[model samples]
Target: MSDGIPLIPVIPQALREAAHRGTLIPFVGAGASRLAGCPTWAQLADGALMACITANKFNHGQMEQIRHLSPRMKLSIARAIESEHALTIDYEKLINPFDGYQNNAVGHRVYRSLGKLSKTFVTTNYDAWLDTEILDPPLSVSTDSPVQDTVATPRVRRRIANVEDFTPANLNQENCVFHIHGSLVDPAGMVMTTRDYIRRYANDRGSDDPTRENRTLTFLEVLFQHKTVLFVGYGLEDLEILEYVIQKARQQFPSERPQARHFMLQGYFAHEYELMRSLTQYYAQCDIELIPFRRDQRDWGQLTEVLEAFAEAMPARAPLELQVQMEMESYLEP
Candidate 1:
């Protein structure tokens, strides 16, 4: 699954080398969480629209007029509605309309495979699919408090650092996930709208906030510079940050193929392969490569298998907790 069909030999081998060196960092996106029953950006903006309508800030007619607008633009309007009416929209509920979605089997497998692939992870999504223990193996606790143990223990190593906290120390911590956009843990801070993105990533050199100026920019630089990044689940539809960072890295680190270090797992039909040549060249210029996956159908159902392949390519290893459990079980009477 890793080597021959969709992924060429060079691509999988490159990923394998990175995994063994523990330098591979998976830059995850909404699609990864969507598999676990989370909503898309469009759905999120629609939720905001419904919230506005419920508050009488927007009418059905207004919703129809802006139905063609982009998700970010709708969210910008939603933010405006929030400001004007003082209505609070619950984003987490919108993200997961179906309760217990964190326990989706597909989401669990993807997250587990990701954990095996890299020590550090990055994601723009606000969902807890990547870090929560609900979908992962449970931690042992006093028999009296099963629910407390479930909520407290995280699957991947424990730290959840936000964008501002993307410091040298945080990145080095084993199994720390860097939530660049923001997380459900802080709803108000999630970067949802166009304005939110500008505020988050814009280079305000003369800003009063000395601690935050170019912080995200510099963090992105560090990632493209130091780590071997494999972008998973991004559709390349939102090319703003990815395009900027890769181009910056191209200039900052000039080499024969400085962009060769980054790869994106893109799904497409076999027929579309000929059409993507130009796009492939563009990605190459930006110092990024596409590891194209041929999809049998429209949906990306096979992504977990590819991720698992990358994980299995490295030396055989299990999660430390799982290892402990196995050892303890062996020592005890069955």
Candidate 2:
């Protein structure tokens, strides 16, 4: 069924090379979790806002106003709820629904495939699905749970909240799962409100502030600068982080040259040539190559098919003889 879906000619080979070279990193988005029964940002925000308004016993006029707002206006609702209730919305509650939901086939396959290729995974999701279901066996190496591996073998199952925690040692160890926007384990760390966004992306506290002053942005810049990022399960609506990174890149690297170390797998239709062209050019400014999976229908199953094909096309692990030869060559170098 998925074979009918089309991809840009060079995407498969390009992705294959990155996987073989261990340079490819998966940047998961909310769509991946949605596949696993988790709600989207709009859904979570709308639900939480409605609950808060009802709990507070607002007047009929105010209640009607809240009820009439579109789901897309969730952020605004969240802010209103915060102001009226004087309570911080716990986004962890939204992620709780995914706690025990069985893994969706597509998400399971995508992550399993990713685990075979790279050691590090990065995402903005608050759910624990990636840590609990996908990157499971390695046991999340940490100070409390140390991993025993030789230099030739690296463990990549650890999860970190902040970008600063992604140290040189962690990067070298591989298999590090970074939740750049906090995880369910830490509700206080989650960035949900408009105030949180301002603090994270707008406020500038100079070089000393970790909350602002471009610390997180710099971390992303450094990460993207060195790794080949493959963006999966993301749509145009989920462009906040991508847009921020692009803005930072432009400010940091003002050169006219284009960079293309990142790729995004998105769905497109046959008749949307103008839209595709415009989006391609728009992302080109950020040096991200957009690979569109041609969709005959509007369903998301095509994404799963594309991912499955991509994973299947990845070259198998190097042969034992080649591994031994490489090890011997490295041993002789010193």
Q: Please give each candidate's TM-score.
A: 0.80, 0.74
lDDT of 2 by residue, 1-334 (tens): 1243365334556667767766577788887677666787778866676666666634456646766565446555566657666766666666656443343545555555555556667888877656632433344457886774211222336778874684433443454678877887776677766667666665253446555455566556545655568887788887766887557644655654433278888777766656777887888767788887777664556666676566667632432345335534543453
Provide the global lDDT of candidate 1 against the true structure: 0.69
Best by lDDT: 1
* TM-score of model 1 (CA atoms): 0.80
Q: What is the clash tally of candidate 1?
A: 1
Poorest stretch of ten by lDDT in candidate 1: 1-10
Query: Model 1, residue 200: what's the lDDT?
Result: 70
Q: Write model 1 residue lDDT over 109-128, tens digit each, in one string.
A: 77776776777778888877
